[model samples]
Target: MSKPLRALDEAALVLFSGGQDSATCLAWALARFGRVETLGFDYGQRHAVELDCRETLREGLRKQNPLWKERLGMDHTLALGALGDISETALTRNAEITMEKDGLPNTFVPGRNIIFLTFAAALAARRGIRHIVTGVCETDYSGYPDCRDDTIKAVQVALNLGMDSRYVLHTPLMWIDKAETWKLAEELGGPALVSLINQESHTCYLGDRGTMHPWGHGCGECPACALRRAGWEEYVAEKARA
Candidate 1:
């Protein structure tokens, strides 16, 4: 008889936002942690359509992996922050979500990830979980100052200090580029990750769903689109070579 799969024996809270990276991280958490819970924030992002995808993904995931889903115990919440009103970032304000020519791109929602992680940390502490998982990748990412390794480390420290708890922030996608991220997903669980990312996850800020553009839908002209397209091209090329 085969032995039962070993559980990670650690509870984790995932800062899920229904994006491809976050969704991949979610899958990773389900596989790695004994118990996992997901949290979604509605900080008034311009791409509110992604929330719908989040709900759909959560339900589908539960259906597909009933045991894993039961163990994870998903919880979705909304926080009222004027992300679209006060922030000058493209993701929040009226500025176009284009490539970063100067420093961080206009879409760089100042303190957005920090806020999310902070909340996740607090929630984790309350639930007696020591691990917090996020999907912020420096590679193939928008030039968001908040998405860098340094920023994440700083936030980790701040969260620990603020809550007076020993919590570890896990960035499964930190060192990997998008092409490699796709590969990691496959390594973890083959087509499950690929299919979820392709059909369910939302990467487009413009919310374009008509095109199966491989890298998920965006304007196909923005910085996000370019990075995603490049990653998809690399993934396809590598697959063909293999």
Candidate 2:
């Protein structure tokens, strides 16, 4: 992400989930690309609050800057209820979130990212876009195999060859930690953007919007909440030091 942005003619579609990570990625795309469209998945996640939060985050992001307002494009949502119908994980089911003996969390929904990228690539092809942005990161994550950088690289190659499209999947947050992600939002759009994410984006696996934490709203115990909380705290601490 240290490199300069490509020309404005290069359009991008974002894999937006209306969660903190995805929202940040959306902002990243808007800041760099000329036309940015968002695509979300309704894979029957228990935390369906994210689906409801998408429009709010999108609207807020577009308004944060005039350029963002101009670049933000159409939004799309696909219903992948089959992924949930087959996924018995905590995210897709009402089961309690827990760690598996094999070191991966129960929240890991196999092939979810792959399916998302495949569908996103198809959508991008239809829209004549060449770049796709996603928020998947291994620096601060739940040990999902699909979120790894190598996995995304492999997926990108597979996508381009299978579809015969020269689509470049962008992963700006792949090497950055959560603390850096918070800083990235500020660097892209300042405090207003940070506030928008804190108030609009949904990340709790439990879908507990009723309970509000300093970082955001969540049960504060789930892995997602814990990671976000820790990151926010570290980011705030670094800001104070500066």
Candidate 3:
């Protein structure tokens, strides 16, 4: 059997973007660790509105569960990068984010996750924390090569070796699909997970605020939308069957 996670005493630095997967990971971190600090990157993506949503979610969590914030330790930091101006990817550029093509999509920011994780790790190390959590998943990711499990493992090794510290990189959603991710949120048992995902998270490049879309924002025809829709369907089906 797999070993249970070690009794984590130090705070967990979560690389949160206030999106569905990241939000789920945040909830999981809140339950698993003694403290949780969230970090969001203003990586100049097409949908900048998500950052606003992230702030709202963070504030809501703080107000709703004051004890969790006080006892478990909750905080957030914003990092700014010129990803939109420098990167030619669809997520950063004006191109359409699609799934018809194979391999990595135009939406893939070359070293986006690596850069984000590196920053998070550095923050953790500085704060005397050893655990860093991210929500990257290979199972249902948007053809982003950086989100692969192997990539995360490689990054973990590098972080430890470079920092010469006992840092642990946690990818709670690494092996699971989006459906399983939603299940994880359900298991956490709080409006913090489902409600935040439904109302606050932003997955759209166009920044559509319309509720007509099933998942949340953006045109539902895109690749991100399709993955989200499929996951939601599976989650609802599983919940109904149960």
- Best by lDDT, which number? 2
**Which candidate tops TM-score?**
2
TM-score of each: 0.89, 0.98, 0.89
Worst 10 residues of 1 by lDDT: 1-10
lDDT of each: 0.77, 0.92, 0.75
Stronger candidate by lDDT (1 vs 2): 2
lDDT of 3 by residue, 30-106 (tens): 77777788888887777777777876766666665654465345455655566556788777777876543566667
Q: Which runs in model 3 stand beyond 4 Å of their true positions?
A: 1-8, 63-67, 71-74, 99-102
Clashes of 1: 1
In model 2, residue pairs whose N, Cα or C atoms come closer than 3 Å (at least 3 residues apart or on different chains), thus clashing, are none
C-alpha root-mean-square deviation, each candidate: 3.8, 0.8, 2.3
Off by over 4 Å in 1: 1-7, 98-101
Worst 10 residues of 2 by lDDT: 1-10
